[model samples]
Target: MPKIVRHGTRVGGDALSIRIVAPPERRASRGSVFVPPLIGGSGMQQVGYFRELNRRGYRLVTFDYRGHGKSGGRFFVRNTIEDARAVLEELRGEFAGEPLFGVADCFGCIPLLCAAAERPEAFRALALFNPIPSLQHVAGPREVLANYFLPRDGSGARRLALRNPFDLRGMLYATNQRLFPGVDKSRDHFGILRYTRARTWLATWEYLSSRPLAGVVSAVPALVCFGRSDRLLGLEDPAAEERYRALWLRHLPRCEVRVLADVDHYWTGTQARASVAAADFFERGGAVANALPGSTLAPRARYRDPGEAPGRKNQLGGWSRSSGLKRASGR
Candidate 1:
């Protein structure tokens, strides 16, 4: 066990909370900050992961965004990013001059990418799990329902959903369970949904759907892991998977993208397995040269015209390995 400290801090006038876990004295110099998914709180849901990370030689910091459990203000995309930056600033002060790594899962990837782009030198490397490449990736029935349920409009439906968040809660919970049945449900994860306000719908949708990841490219290394069977992000299909792989390669050519076979969006039973991938990536300094023993490199993909679908037949010929990108999977 390690010393765990909790505190409430103000980021851009919004009160946010964080839990800091100190690593063992021998590995105190190494630190990794984990940015959790949309379900925010006192960081209890991911306590298991961060604690394991700490045991693996990394000091850990996890936080809750505004409007989430133990945090003040509304949950908005921009506010969450600011919350993350504030938490990072706090951690940097504690581990001054130490090498830093970032681990973001689900929606956490957005702000992590934004933070990396804003302060390229802040982190030495970043490990992203099931990253939402863009809001468009998650846009669908949920997005539509969220927009229809926006509290700003003061609609009857909005009032109902807020009055009984369980309806929306079940929808989200079932979605997760379907995607990753092996997820540990021992923690009280209902807080993320319970505290969510109707106003968050509009803000979340706007940021997720419109925010462009292309502009955030940097020299900093990123280890991107995607579950091959992810339904939420729909990387299961070969074509869809290739498109996103090409997208990331186009933006961050040096990035190492590993596709975990049979895994889903939430990582479910793959936590320990994924952690190994992250540990290896961090140890290799984000280079593919030292990728997991079975990992291999593929050529970088170039961005095609927006009007042209990725891998669509063209004058150059149909989709092929020579077309710039190929699927690469590893543990």
Candidate 2:
């Protein structure tokens, strides 16, 4: 069942709209939140993912950010945290039983990390995938807007033709801070961009700091997965993998981390396989499940029986240790 709700109190000041998928027969009472990508408010890319998660008997909630989708707002940088909080409040209000799980993608996870550090009551478990906190991609606001709204058309020319990085970015920084969200291409998320630029600098600034996520410590279980290939790292200096590992290890000791293979910064070929792994990981009560084939949809990673472990198939075609992910990872 998909239901819509007014996420705000005002009549016309601006209301957030949320779409939820209720569990089938078990009558799920717990809810999981999936934060959409920068410009993907309609969540069309996630429908298939939601369908699969619904089968797991979990109530899943997704919403258009302040400006990106059905919600009211204009585009802008820095409003990420506020929107995440608003969504969390709605879920907490609707569900009285079951755990609150959060799954954040790409730039969407920053605010949640900020919230976990500042407002811990918001949610419980979290699954963050390839969340890059630094806005080091550019220095100006116009560039920020373009990067947020531009489609990854897979065209070098299209990407470069979209905007002039140096000049536009300078213009953005020179513009007034109170009303810049309007510059972002997405009309729906513009309002939030406008409001957040005016008040959400604290989290952004802290995230840019040397310690960055130092303040965050999730009491609830957390899963942080990074694609093996991300353009974020420039060679040696600070390998992206090591940086993330160090950050989470220090701030979130209970966190579990995984490096997805055969993928790059964009997660090109491994999306389905990765999502399946993630869904299984979450549904399995936070246990670390090994990946299957290039993918596996098994609820709990039972792998093969001891006898059928990877190497020896014995007489029967049943169990084998050489066949499972744990054996490969030596887990």
Candidate 3:
């Protein structure tokens, strides 16, 4: 069995719950940090992946997004990035010598990309499953509007006045199941409907749609995998892969882009494959990058502050690795 340790970090006034799982040792020979997708904070969503990675001897760290699962503070797009920086800081202190890898799913890709863009050297490689560059690209305007009721710090009364009555994400899930047989609608899920704050939804839509995909680039090797039949991103069409290939090539030309035939947007039964792909990418190193024919590794560059981009500096609160965090729990 793997040893589990829990940590809490006060980030921008919010307390984040993070879990670190490692083989029975102080440290592992290799490790990677897992950034949960939107609605991905619960350990229930990630424990399987953790166990699978553990079998490969990789230490794993996963955290609950604020307002989701047991973490404190309201969830929002900017907060996601802030929380991610805090997690990375903690990872540095706990697992120093080994190369760190980053793995994320769906909307989690936004913050992962933002964090990686801001600190390219922080991760040795990155793998994004069913990545969404912008929610606006996938969701309808009505759904986007449903998330813009009140300000981040609005009074409860004010927030209630503007609250959305419709379960937009739930409707999306229903529609997805109808469109694709692969979506496992049978299993119950604690989806975004329960923890999604209006401010968080609005902020995510804005951040994702506004940010340039090129800025999400990294000097390290990158792998982007999505289901060929993903209804959310419309990758089912044969032309979709080529479209994404063209888009990703513009920013990260050397990144390996794979379109899995049987996978779906939710990754319902495909968790094992995703875990294995991540391990292969991190373990094989240059071999994985080399395997993507017709692409040469990009030149390594010093960490450039991605915040220098227009309107990005203050978009997410400043990042700090300062040490005032308390060990909320451990085992």
Leading candidate by lDDT? 1
Ranking by TM-score: 1, 3, 2
List, residue by residue over 1-331, the lDDT tens digit for candidate 2: 3433334321125566566656666555435655443432243233333344555665666655555445665443444566666666666777755566666655556666766656556556677766655554313445455553452355523243344443432333332121222122222122123333232344234324533344666665567776444433221223645676666656556567775543443344344454565566666666533442333122222121112111122111111121111111110
Q: TM-score of predicted model 3?
A: 0.68
* Better candidate number, 1 or 2, judged by TM-score: 1
Worst 10 residues of 3 by lDDT: 315-324
lDDT of 3 by residue, 1-331 (tens): 5667887677877788887767546545576565553542353245443346667777767776776656777766556777777887887777776678787776677777777777777788888777777655465554434334422233433242344446445444433333333222322222322334325356436544565344666565678887655666765444776786666655555578776665556554456678788878778772445555343222322222222211111111111011111221110
- All models: lDDT? 0.58, 0.46, 0.56
Compared with the true structure, the alpha-carbon lDDT of candidate 2 equals 0.46
Residues 17-66 of candidate 1: C-alpha lDDT, one tens digit per residue: 77776777767445565555454333544444434566678766777667
The best-first sequence of candidates by lDDT reads 1, 3, 2
After superposition of all CA atoms, the RMSD between model 1 and the true structure is 13.1
Error (Å) of candidate 2 at residue 230 is 2.4
Q: Mark the regions of model 3 whose C-alpha exceeds 4 Å error after superposition.
A: 24-28, 142-214, 291-331
lDDT of 1: 0.58
